[model samples]
Target: MYAFKKSLSMGFDQAVEHVVEELKKEGFGVLTDIDVAATMKAKLNVEGRPYRILGACNPPLAHRGLGLDPDLGILMPCNVVVREEEDGSIAVVFMNVATVTGLSSAEGMKELGEDAAAKLQKVHDAL
Candidate 1:
């Protein structure tokens, strides 16, 4: 699977903040925050539900991945998505590091992927 998902029983803005806090507890930081809905509205003049794509990174883990393969930088930061459901509920989705890292054959990459995935799972469970 490309991602893990969870429903959040909170307001959209609150859920976004909560996800960021949970990620920090796991040593991850939000490096980039893309407001998809707002961007679409500004660029394409389209209407849509609230959605955001957060680029999350753990500096230590990213450093390790880079040391293994410089090209791995392309996949360094994982993406987490926060969006509102049609029913007005909030949902958050986390990137599956294992699935993405499996594309590389670098030594110890599998273990690294598993480690990151476990940490993300903890954040998922925290919600």
Candidate 2:
């Protein structure tokens, strides 16, 4: 509904690496990589499975979106999450740009969102 999800039969680190590579191929870059598991353990003294939140961005598309609506910056970079499941499988999830962008009232936001979603779909299909 709000995201595209896939389960990977690979190591946690490997899955993250693969997802990053695929994003790059789709003209997306990893702007930030947050290791949620480690952060939680250090900041809250809680243990958890391996989990990472990747902030991905496509510079050209971001520029266009900004030109259309400055406030769209709130959703600038997309998110791709890679987390280890209790079943020992890795899960890779991608933000559904179309769903999020639909919230905007900008004139061309829908088309822009569809374009971005297609690119992400390519990455999803690749993996």
Summarize candidate 2's per-residue lDDT along 8-56 as a digit string, tens digits: 9999999999999999999999999999999999999999999999999
Q: Point out where model 1 deviates above 4 Å.
A: none
- Model 2 Cα shift for residue 85 (angstroms): 0.5
RMSD of each: 0.6, 0.6
TM-score, cand. 1:
0.98
Model 2 lDDT on a 0 to 1 scale: 0.94
lDDT of 1 by residue, 98-125 (tens): 9988988999888889989999999999
Clashing pairs in 1: none
CA deviation > 4 Å runs, candidate 2: none
List TM-scores for all candidates, in order. 0.98, 0.98
Candidate 2 worst ten-residue window by lDDT: 68-77
Q: Rate the local accuracy (lDDT) of all candidates.
A: 0.93, 0.94
